[model samples]
Target: MARSETESERLKRIAILNARLPRTRAIAQGVLRDPKGRVLLCELSYKREWDLPGGVVDPGESPATCVEREIFEELGLSVTVGRLLAVNWLPPWRGWDDALLYLFDLGVHHAGELDPALYLRREIAGAHWRSIADAAAHVAPYTARMLEVAADAEHPLYLENSEPGRTR
Candidate 1:
């Protein structure tokens, strides 16, 4: 029979097991819209396509918390996260590994209230309010699908590779 383990030993074992498990990266993004239903998209310096405002979730940080933090960090705007919008599974692409992306609502604001010039982050070239159809031409194909699905979805969605999935 095996001897009982101390708390420290148990914790060490758990840590080892945790590290051995598969790690799927998590990304958090927020959908900000205006009364006209135009979505706010950020022009990224690193990428050609404009994208929603958010970033990778840090260790021990919740997705909601991560979006709020990323918004302020990248856009210099303090925002409260709203309801969850969608959960999309991304397959390995563009030299990056697979990741799960959480989309959250950031509520609506008057178009005049948001000024892209004020977002001084180096990574952000600009931000713009674009209609869904118009945004598709400026964003990635997957992002466009995500926007279309999320906008039309009546409830929270679960997507696989940016498309509607069997699981909700």
Candidate 2:
């Protein structure tokens, strides 16, 4: 005869899984700067905090692809994502365990109209190009470091193992 599993045990397993999900959520962030040298910032609905324009890497999506897709969806513009910037390892916040953030240098070109249609598509309450220093002061510390690197155009940001070359 075999022993049967209990409902309590099943519930415990689900609880464990739920706790682990956030731990595995890896994010890709971008520090996009327009030609005028202002960095783009977005106001998230969750914290209502201003942040750099970037998001998580979807299942089977490359970091570059994620960044570009985020740009079009959020800003309503076709963008050229440049060199890799910094890799931030965020320990769990708000009951999450772990997160890996890949920061990239994004180049914005005025390629579309910023109007109601685009604004209504995303949860972006506002979109604006702010001075790097000003943007840095408003976002999280990890993002602040990203802006610090991006502000210095002479010193291009690169990932840990990426070779010397601009992505696009």
Candidate 3:
């Protein structure tokens, strides 16, 4: 027969059980454009190519909040995350599990408005506004595709693995 458990023991048991449950990883990215229609990309200290301003969603946080939080943490820029731009599902790659990437529209800024020196965080090596063609060459393939779709999207797009076959 089992004896009654103490409150502390019960809490510990629940924590252990939670740790064993499967988890899904979600990332949020923001799309910002300059007055000249150049896309904003940040050079990460850990990666060779540039990426949008965002990061992984923390547990119990919504994707919208995650993007705003990540941008502030990464760029020191407080931005109102606007409409959802795209949702791309990524398969497992680089030894990481599959993840869903949420893209948010951050609207446009005038030329010379954003000063890299004033807002860039330590994790960012640099920030630049580049034409779509130039940004495509500097970002990942999936990112390039997302940019293309986002630029012309009249409404939010949902893609499966960044492919057109599945969109809603």
Candidate 4:
């Protein structure tokens, strides 16, 4: 004779299995350029380096949708997220767990549309438009590498630690 599983036991088993799975964090960032060919970067209040406009991806949200949502929430700019440019796997850093960063194209707009005075979120200290070379100097090293490739990529790429040819 076989014993039937109780609801309590089934719930405990599911909880245990879920806890054992990999739980890497996910981030969605957008690359919005101005007519002058400068990428829009955010000066985050908490970090020294300026970064592309975006935020962490909430659970169950698609990366494309996450980028669109993040751009509006963080900068108060409603943007239509374009094709995914790259999927970069980031290693753990500065006490945060490993994460996958999805980079999407936010399309170009006139520079005047992102005035600092219009900022809606306190997390953003300001917004800057920088050329690829200039942005590389101010953003994180990983971000710099990602920009180097993703900026000119005609198709999507998979990067590891923001470096090409390392995807696994």
lDDT (tens digit, per residue) of candidate 4 on 76-154: 7889988899999999999999999999988998876765666755689888899999988899999999999997799
lDDT of 1 by residue, 1-168 (tens): 989999999999999999898889999998899898889999999989999989999999999999999888788788999888899999998999999999988899777776676775678998889999999999999999999999666789999888998953
User: Order of candidates by lDDT, top first?
Assistant: 1, 4, 3, 2
Clashing pairs in 1: none
Candidate 3, 1-168: lDDT as tens digits? 989999999999999988997666999999888878887898998878799889899989999999998877777677889899888888887788988999998888764655676655557887788988888889988888888877668888887666654523
lDDT of 3 at 79: 81
Q: Candidate 3, TM-score vs. the true structure?
A: 0.82
Quote model 2's TM-score. 0.67
Model 3 error, position 68 (Å) = 1.3
Q: Could you tell me the TM-score of candidate 1?
A: 0.91
In model 4, the clashing pairs are none
Query: What are the clash counts of all predictions, listed in order?
Result: 0, 0, 0, 0
User: Residue 165 of candidate 4: its Cα lDDT?
Assistant: 57
Native-vs-model 3 lDDT? Answer: 0.83
**Model 4 error, position 116 (Å):** 2.5
lDDT of 2 by residue, 1-168 (tens): 978779999899989997786546667767666677777787766665688777788988988788788868876666667777665556567686676667777756432344535752447777767887787667776566656654454654543222223557
User: Judged by lDDT relative to the true structure, which candidate is superior, 2 or 3?
Assistant: 3
- Each candidate's lDDT (Cα)? 0.89, 0.66, 0.83, 0.88
Better of 3 and 4 by lDDT: 4
Candidate with the greatest TM-score versus the true structure: 1
Worst 10 residues of 3 by lDDT: 159-168
Off by over 4 Å in 1: 1-3
Error of 3 at 91 (Å): 0.5
